[model samples]
Target: MKNTLKNKDISQTPFRRDVLKIFNSHKNAIPLSVIEQELSSYNRVTLYRTIKSFIEKNIIHEIVISGEESKYALSKENKDTPYQQHIHFKCRSCNILFCSELDKAITISLEKHKIERLDIQAFGICNKCNIS
Candidate 1:
């Protein structure tokens, strides 16, 4: 965790470390409410700021799904890629949001437009849910 912060040039702070730990422990993206529940002693504003900082540094990314609170997950590092371009899947049975890598690269072309980031979401029963 400390190495991740260092790589992103983020200062090593106790609160930041704790927040990263929460993200690391979970395989799925989490909402702010969950983080608050886990770190109940921390101030809400502080947590928000920490999340913002991580986003700015590309240490994490936000997942926005309709009719639900925004969720956050650690960014997958790709030294050659400047932006994250992957699918976010939500299991309807478990309601767990997680990232999934695309099988092939997606190509998009827009006339006179620049795309900085792309977030695609799919909702269905995930593998674990399908087996049960």
Candidate 2:
């Protein structure tokens, strides 16, 4: 986490390190409320600022699904394209949001139009939930 902060040119503070640890511990995207609950002693403003910094520095990316609060996931390093272009999955059963990569990349083309970013989201019962 310290190395990630350093690479992103962000100051490595104790609070920032703790925040990153929370992100690292989870596999799925997480909401601010979960972070607040985990670090109950910290002020809300401080946590918000830390999250903002992480987002600005591309250490994490926010996922906004309709009718739900935004969630954040750590950005993968050394990718050719922006991580947001990858598909996002939301489990209907578990209500967990996560990133999923497809076996083959999807491509779209349009004449006289430039496509910048693409967001694809799938909703279904994830494997774990399907098994239960």
Best TM-score among the predictions, by candidate number: 2
Residue 98 of model 1: what lDDT? 94
Q: TM-score per candidate, in order?
A: 0.85, 0.87
- Per-candidate clash tally: 0, 0
lDDT of each: 0.85, 0.84
* Tens-digit lDDT string for candidate 2 (42-92): 988898899998988888889999899999998774345554358889999
Clashing pairs in 2: none
lDDT of 1 at 102: 83
The 10-residue segment with the lowest total lDDT in model 1: 76-85
Candidate 1 residue-wise lDDT, 1-119, digit = tens: 43267767789999998899899889889999999889848987899899999998888889887789999998886354755468999999999999988877677768979866666
